[model samples]
Target: MTTAVAAPFRFFSLQVVRTRRLGPSLARVTFAGPDLHAFHSDGRDQSLSLFLPHPGQPEPAVPVELGWESPRSGEAGSGGGWWQAWRELPDDVRAVMRSYTLRALRTGEDGHTTEIDIDFVLHGVEPGSPVQAGPAARWAAGAAPGDRVVMLGPAVADNRAIRFRPPADTDLVVIWGDETAVPAACAAVESLPAGTRARVWLEVPHAEDVQDLHTAAEAEVTWLVKGAAAGPEATLATLRAAELPPTTHPYVWIAGESGRVKRLRRHFVGERGIDRRRVTFVGYWRQGLTEEQLREQG
Candidate 1:
């Protein structure tokens, strides 16, 4: 659903203002453009489809018409509208469409949007190479101040891309994820109302990868890193050893590897008796598979 591009969404041409390594495996790229003034989001894990250029291209490839809607033709953005039209273009022109969470956003007092930050995981396919160094990682690793790309993001304050929707009766909140889910968890945590009770567990690749976190909610954060005797098994060990609060009205959000997320979901729903509907679980990516492969499977 993050890749859904349609009305209430439009193309925004953005230029990179700067890029910095946030941690050993994370890079934060700040983007700015005139079109960003209309970009809006509700902040909780909001997603956008990025159009990154091929290795040597100056600008990202896009259709000349900039996708549009024709309700008279009965085409929705998914079935026969944007998705279909995008598919009809040449493979090289369509480029690579990847979904990403909005890490941060700033607006000026004059009411104009100033900047938006997106964090990219410096992962590659091989160990010591990053998590999985594909085109996005390649771009981020070498991004200059003026690099540009296109994205189909929110134009309204509240849209469907935000996947973190907790119920009104929710009391305790539990969120966990690997490095890829950090941006999502980061955005979602700050949205919690003040005094809300929440527990956050984040797993990254390095101890230096543990960055600062802020939240108005009563949050307890724990960082698990690779090679720190806190790998997957260690995560399960911690989960099994801990005592969680009562779960009659609990809300849980889990993301990362498909298998791990499923395991956590079962633990909460099967063991903890949390309502299945109260859990928002997403597998951002799967091990041994790329985003393109996942899309094809979907």
Candidate 2:
């Protein structure tokens, strides 16, 4: 009998089809598979779950004891299938699961996905370097054409992970982020309506990391390159000194280092007097802390 999977962690098999370097620090990997036709996306800031393999392991193995019930057993329809199931896994096993935004998603006239692009940061590896780094980054660095991985993403186009929500009457949109947030930011730009206007401040490790963004919205983007100024000190200085255009009906989106996100939140709500209701803030990552560590601390 075919099982109707109620679990959000339902797996969809995919394989790498190609890879491209978008900038000095970003590597774009394209994946394709038959199951992709059911891989729905909400189009803006849409992120998905990826399961990568440990070094020396060809594929991921989610043990039954870890609470990841297999669809084959028709047991995936049970209790909290994300974190609760995750908590049951060994720490190293849990570390292999990471979240990533869809840089691009394409569907064919036949209503099947011809391709999907995911841009990965080339982190923790250097010329003649050892492979001690995040599992996801290591996997992407070694991922070749035909390499496979599994995803737990949207089964329907409308899902909660697409967080770029602004009221219809919003006349101006403000966005900010660092390299890690670039995929989501660019996706937001792509989602704006034809006449939408936006001011975007994006920060990256280097100027070469900046790439062209495609959008119909009238946008002015300022690229912030990280230098000697530590923390959000440089970005905070720039944002404080800048003369912002008159905002009619404004909506703000901010995501980056947790510390920076906090500062940005204060700047908008405390200093700029923007209503707390008009903003979406996400802390993608933090310095010296892994995602799991943050969750545990929180």
Candidate 3:
């Protein structure tokens, strides 16, 4: 018999409190749950597994109370009425689940009500695309004030943590990412030592995706457009090839689509011979996988 490991944490039910449009393809959904009291505040780019009920299903089951068993068990204690039916579902036809980042977090006065923000990338009508005009996107775009969903995972350890405490003599720092990786880049920038010299590169599908970021370090910012001839790797290569001040320390951070990020990581750590410990590289998302799938693969 397989022994089940108790989930390190429990999931909470949250209602869609609000929604905001960040871009033509990005929408932010805010949810408030009582379980937020246990959330680790420093988690950014961390993923949460969202359990969305099937269309027309009366309600969703609570993962914690039901344990980490598959939701296919039917509504909790509804009798084995639908349990056997749910168990008969094909592996691929099960209810949909998606992973998304914790873009922002806020705590209520009593610390019981916590609001968290997550962005969903709208993939325009592409068949098989995770964000295609399907049930999940429809649910997110039209989530009602009282509609409930299950939130699992803060997945704290999954993030690539970077701690940068450069020596006083250090000089230059470079950070770059595609829009999906922006949260991590922002977190890294905010954590850098005061007065550090840095350059930031952000790539997005359109000009409007750019947002002003505040940081204490001395820095120059650049925005690159997707589909432009100068891809992220080329852009980073150009910057890396430039002459630098002798005392500048190079702390490089690059993340985004898997292919592009892998290329940049190789160039910086292999060809350029930078110290491995001095660079932080993360593959935030891949070109063609849902965030949940990525987490499973990892």
Best by lDDT: 1
Compute each candidate's TM-score over C-alphas: 0.89, 0.86, 0.70
lDDT of 2 by residue, 161-249 (tens): 77889888898999998888898898888888788889999888667788988789998888887743545777888888877778867
lDDT of each: 0.82, 0.77, 0.63
Report the Cα lDDT for candidate 1: 0.82
CA shift of 123, model 1, Å: 0.6
Superposed on all Cα atoms, the candidates' RMSDs to the truth, in angstroms, are: 4.3, 4.3, 7.1
RMSD of 3: 7.1
Worst 10 residues of 1 by lDDT: 68-77
* Sequence-dependent TM-score of model 1: 0.89
Q: Higher lDDT: candidate 2 or 3?
A: 2
* Better TM-score candidate (1, 3): 1
Name the regions of candidate 3 deviating beyond 4 angstroms.
1-8, 58-62, 66-95, 110-113, 125-138, 155-173, 190-194, 228-249, 290-298
lDDT for model 2: 0.77
lDDT of 3 by residue, 184-277 (tens): 5666576565687878877776677666677788877777767445565576576567554444357777777878877877777888777777
TM-score of 3: 0.70
Model 1: how far residue 291 lies from native, Å: 1.2
As for TM-score, the candidate ahead, 2 or 3, is 2
